[model samples]
Target chain A: MWDTFILNPMINALLMLYDFLGNNFVLAIAVFTILIRLLTLPLNLRQQRSSMKMQEMQPQIQAIQKKYKDNPQKMQEEFQKIGYNPAESLAGCLPLLIQMPILIGLYRAIIIVLGSTPQSLFELTARVYDYINLTDLLPISNKFLWLNLAQPDPLFVLPVLVFGTMFLQQKLMTPATKKQESKGKKQQDDNPMAGMTQSMQWTMPIMFGFFSLQFQAGLSIYFVLSNIIGIGQGYYMRRSMAQLKEEQATKKPAVIKAESETAVASPPQQSKQDDAALDAAMKGTPEERKQYQPRKRTSKRKRRRR
Target chain B: MYAAKRPLRRPVIFLLIIASYLFVACGVQTANTNWPGLSTDGEKVYVAYGPEVVAYDVESQSKTWSFPAETNPTLQFFAAPSVQDGRIILGDFGASGGMLSPGVVVTLYALNDTDQGVPGSIWTNGELVSDRVVAPPLQVGDQLFVGTANNFIMSIDATTGAKQWEFEVGHSIWGQPAYKEGVLYLSSLDKSIYALEAETGQELWQTELSGALASSPVVNTDLVYVASFDNQLHALDIQTGQEKWAASAQDWIWDAPAFADGVVYFVDIQGNVYAVDGASGDQIWSQQLNLPVQTSPVVVGETVYIASGDDLDAENPQGALTALNVADGKQQWQKTAPGPLFTTPVVVGDSIIVALQSDQDLLIAFDLETGGQNWDYLPPQE
Candidate 1:
């Protein structure tokens, strides 16, 4: 099932791109990565929008939790009034989850496509489509610049670039850290999600960069190109989201109400707090923003005691 | 809510690491890179496949001795061992000491074959080359010639394991070089045949073909025949590296054409067997088996022995050894094997020895006359 649906199609598509791109495998990889990023643009945009909305609702959410601290059911009703659902925050990870399969599939494809050994060539031939004219394409050119696409880079150039580009992408995607928040609030906001994302910003890049040391140079090229495309996508999403926030801030009260009803409905009384929360969410660190989030469930005994 | 979300953080990172490792392993692990290399010297057969090379006695029908008493995971032996006198010479795929080392260091081992239990290396030259030796080493007198995957052919002192001279080619050499009349003939993936001086490693002449030559050139009286990945069989002038005649095939011709009775017999990877006149390159008879053939057909008496693998698209892939009449390409007899037969079968006395990549059997022998099983040998796994 994996081969027929994911591997075969990807291999063929890559071969077609190779054929069309003057048989330059590096160009084929770069173009293919860009196309894939474009295809997933919608999901990325949706995830970014969800993050922005969640950031804007932080202060109001904190206020509701404080006002209804003793009344558990009343707090739940107020959360509904503000149209805040904690589950929507998980959507921020959806786009990343979707990319894992693509990475695995493309890795397999590159290995076989640039295969220099007889067994790998035989395996490639078996997976190739009938129309590809594999006879003419028996030996794919694997050289580009100082790299033999089938082997790892000897100069450590690609690995460094992979690390640098991935780190930049992670930086762009992660919410800015808030440096001005009180130490107590910062401690309270040290949630797992924030900590995970922060550590991932370093760990993910370092891990992939380490892998790039042993991975084929062709795969490393893909990693660099894909990370670049991701960085571009993040930039584009940030610009559009900022523009949307600006438009929302300048809108009339009736227009804002209509838009809020369709999206995450916000009470008029909390407008200034929402603005302050948005600023903190957009400019502060993920850990700082996470401090305002309410716990999902409370102990029944604690509620009964209250 | 944050605390509940915290648990997911560790698991996500752990899963990502696990998945990355799995994907990296799938890409980096050495799977089937090449087939087993087989050679025989009348009394015993030498098989080099994975980590070790073993010599099996033909008459005793028992194992004689295996090189390298203990298998080393880093070293792989796939090049056929060239046996001459009491010396067994072979080259390894290559290995390195992890990331600290820059490139792989391939070793050329010359072992004392007279050892009855496990042969010890007489001398090993590991510091000379940094590439995989795919082609079998050709030893002439006290000099040994080896072709590597890095597109270089080197001449070493057979007795001292000292590098004498080296010559670079346009591409990797996968076929054994044929040495005759003080000239060494090599076929390369650069789609050319190179003629180098046996003693000095100097190129006398080179003839460019339309496709890569993956098999060694068979030097006859005046012409040397080579099978090409260009789907053609070419006979080149042994002296000047001039093309004499070319015969076309339906697919890539992988092995060198077997010359017998003024006829050259060869098979393409698409399983098309052909017999062409040696002098004129005119096709005599063509037979289509429509399977995957990578081994050269060996002509013995009135029959030609050909080995082929089953369709790779098939669920349970198998292989077959078919004997065909030399005159008309008529099927005389055929026997099936549990795995793919990629190595060329060697005729030792009355038995044709076939090496397979199968787990159940590594080497199988059949009666050359009747195509009946003589014996099968499976090496002990590490």
Candidate 2:
């Protein structure tokens, strides 16, 4: 079922591209990867929107965590109220899930198409569709620059490029804030999620680079090209989201200004002591403010009990 | 609400990445060590699989001896063993520490009939070539000719295993060399057929074709028949190396065309059989079997036997052997096997022997007239 639905179709498409591109397997792989990226652009856009929404809610989520430090269940409820569920935010990876199989299929297709050995070449003949003419493409000249498409690059240039492009894509996809960047080991220990995220950013690229050094150069080419496209898509998506946010902010500035004025005005009508306490709470650190909150509420409850 | 489960996502992503790597690794790291070249000399049948060459007695269908006596895991053989003057001559693709190595030198070994390794019988031993040697060595008189992945054909002294001469071509020579009189004919992936002096390795004449030639040239009298990757078979004059006529085939021809009784019979990789007139290059008859054929057809009297495999079933390929009438291309008899037949069938007296490309049995002999199974031989498991 996998072969019929995924592998065969991918193999045929690659072969067709090879035929159309004058029997150059390298060109075929490049074009096929681009086509795949373009085909998944819609899904990727949706994923990017989901990611942007999560990024936009990070500050509110941190505030909620600080407010509910003493109430674990309330913290969960507050996270739900703010629509900040990390698990649901991971739906952004759906596009990657879809492309993973295609990437693997493309890798196999490159090997089969290159037909390095006699046995592999015969297997290629079997995989070829009847409508596709592969006679001229037999014994595919895997030569592209100094690398043989069938074998890995001797100079390790492709692997380095793969790492470079992938790292760039990951950086663009997950933009860390300046505070997170300046944070030391102690800060990372305090926020375990931040540490894991930072580690994955480096680890994934290095692992892929290692794979590029081991697998055929043709596959590495796909990886590098695909990452570049992903980076471009990420940039575009982020830009479009920023533009939309800017437009929305522009349309509602007066309304936001009115709300802020009203909030400030209401605090002064509570009482002199209450106004001073509110000012101190607003100026204090998150931990100090949370401590101040429980003390004020406990005093009021004790007075009510007496 | 699901933020509490965020800790589990990292491990899941890690597992998915590992799974993707494993999936691609499995597909890319397939066994590239097939193409078991088989040859027979009436008394014994020699089969080259992986690195070892085993000889089986034709009558008893029992193993007689194996070259290198002790098996070496790294050794790989792609060229069929050529028997000449009580010695088995074949080429080795050499060994590598792993698949990532930039390939090693190709060695030609000459072993005696008793399976004893001859002293100093390794020609160009440890000598690095451009690539591996997959073409079978062609033995002529006291000299043996073999082509290398390095795009050079070398002539070696059969007795001393010393290099006599070498001829450089435009591309790698994957097809075996054909000898006639004092001239040798060889085809290369460079889309050209070359004729050279067998003794001096001097190029006499060369003819350019439309596609790369993967099959050895069949030299008969004044004409040479060769198949190419361009899905066409060209008949060339032996003296001038000029094309006499070219017949179009359904697909690529990877096997040499068999000539018998003024007719040439061959099959394409797509299992299309064609019997063409050797003199005029006119198609006598063409039959489509819808299976992939990598082995050449054997002609005996009025019959042409071919071996084909259902390539879709990669794990357990089913092979079909069909006999066609050489005169009219009519089906005579058909037989099926559990595995694919990648080696050509050999006719021994009244029995036909075929080697299977599978894990279980290596060889099976059938009665030529009745198409009945005579016997089968399975190699002892390691």
Candidate 3:
């Protein structure tokens, strides 16, 4: 499945793109990497939403904890009522999982195309095959610029660039600041992502940088492009976060109306903390977007129960 | 020089690996650049010792004066001195060691009566011994012809060493060329022997031999004899390379086969001698000696001489010089010493001088008839 979905198609596409664009392999790899990032953009967006949803629920979670500080069962029941689950916040991991096969394919393509290294002898099913010549018109061997495709690049420039781009992407994509729990009124303003720490931030870049020195330069170029695209997507998503915030604010007035209806039926006034939360949710245009609509218990409660 | 992308330093290591494998698989040979010249003149023995043409006087049992007449500042003596037309012609057949390239130069020298009786340089040319020449000169009329390491058989002016013409053969011609009335015979490392016109070097035809011919092509009156590493003794037609008849030996036929009155005397690597009727190419007698024979044979009137060994016993090492009766292939007498001589005996008039090399070295002489010890001369330092 990978040969068709990733390897063969990517190889053929890269070859075709190289043929059309003066057969410049380095440039082709950069363009190809961007194309792949664009194709997987939807999955990346869903992962962002999942992270945003988790950040918004941090305050509600704190409130649930305060309401039943001594009763663990009551806290759990309140969490079940609200859309707050620790597991759903891990949505960013899906993009990485989906890209694993694509990443390996890119590695192999760079090894064979840029380094001119053939696949392992065992993987070769036939005695002869068509050569994918990148330097077909060059007078000298496929060595060019400062790199020798036959050997590891000596300049160390490519590896550094690859790691730098990865670090930049990671830093820019970090949206929320991790926060500590408090014994007061709950607020989603507490940074949800500040919890992600430093161990992985430096470790991943160092490990990949070390490997980039040994791998082909072409793959290094692709890696750099992938990171750059990821950073750009992060910026775009962050820029559009204001719209998401507005949508959340617009749904707040209906929440307050329902609370008032509850007061008329069983009680008159509720806790001042709940009033403050509903007011915060209705502070902006959230009140205008909120409308009284029929809620589907089958999809909401049943799905949450499962 | 190597490509920037490719690691060229490893190739030298790879060659070492290859050489080591060959050392274990096949064997190594002692390399000697001094050529011991071969001839059919029956009166004189010519050799190139260092820079001079030295000839041994058959009657006086002493070497004639060394001739410095033929000197090439750039060439070396790769093969022994070939005596032709009362002159000593030496080929610079990679003997100098600097020109690892092929195609040696052939230089001739004549006795200068005015120049203090020293042999004076007459003429020198590259046509005679063109690179990698181990073969002696084959004289046809006024022109002397020989093959080269580059796989070309050429004719040169016997008096001037000027090239007349050339004919490309299969591979490097390591064998000494042979000649008949007008046809020139040559063999190559590519396992093919060719017959060419003496004057123009035009190819008449080429015959495929079993293996490479590294030995000197020995010739009789009617039959041209040659040996191959394929362990085959071929008697080819004098005018064409067509096989007159062929004989087989136990191992690679490396040395030039000696021809006597009516029989062809040759040895195999397995220390066996087979006397074949020269006219019919029939094996009249076969005898196994002590060890393998890689050297050529020396034959006189009714007796044949061969060098054989048994085992490398350090002190004895199975080395001996044996003389056999040609008629019955029976050993007449055996001379034992620290010897496994690689050179053929030079029979000068009544005494035979053989250079025997073993742990020690000496040039020994003996009477031709009774094999009595005459005198021995060992080089002072070496």
Interface RMSD, in order shown: 5.0, 6.3, 23.2
Judged by lDDT, which candidate is best? 1
Per-residue lDDT over A29-83 for candidate 3, one digit per residue giving the tens place of the 0 to 100 score: 7788878898889998888767666554544454455445578786676566565
Judged by DockQ cut-offs, the docking class of candidate 2 is incorrect
- A1-306, model 2: which lDDT tens digit per residue? 777788878888988888789878788988998999889988888886776566544434544554555788977875775556877767778988998888878777777776656776777766778887676655466677777676666677887899899988876766453235444343343333444556667768877876775667888889999999989976876677668756866887754343223211111113445545534744676443323321111234456989
- For candidate 3 chain A, the 10 contiguous residues with the lowest summed lDDT are A117-126
lDDT-best of 1 and 3: 1
Taken over the whole model, the C-alpha lDDT of each candidate is 0.78, 0.74, 0.58
Worst 10 residues of 1 chain A by lDDT: A261-270
Tens digits of per-residue lDDT, candidate 1, A1-306, equal 888988888888888888998888899898888888888889988886776576556545655654555788977876776677767778777987998788899988888887656556667877989999766654577779988787677687988899899999987776543311222323223333345556688778877876786677888998999889889877877787668757865865554443333222222223455545544643566444433332222334656999
| Model 3's TM-score against the true structure | 0.47
Q: Which of candidates 2 and 3 reaches a greater DockQ?
A: 2
DockQ category of candidate 3:
incorrect
Each candidate's number of clashing pairs is 6, 0, 18
Give the per-residue Cα lDDT of candidate 2 at B16.
60
Let me know the TM-score candidate 2 reaches against the reference structure. 0.77
lDDT of 2 at B280: 91
TM-score of chain B of each: 0.92, 0.87, 0.76
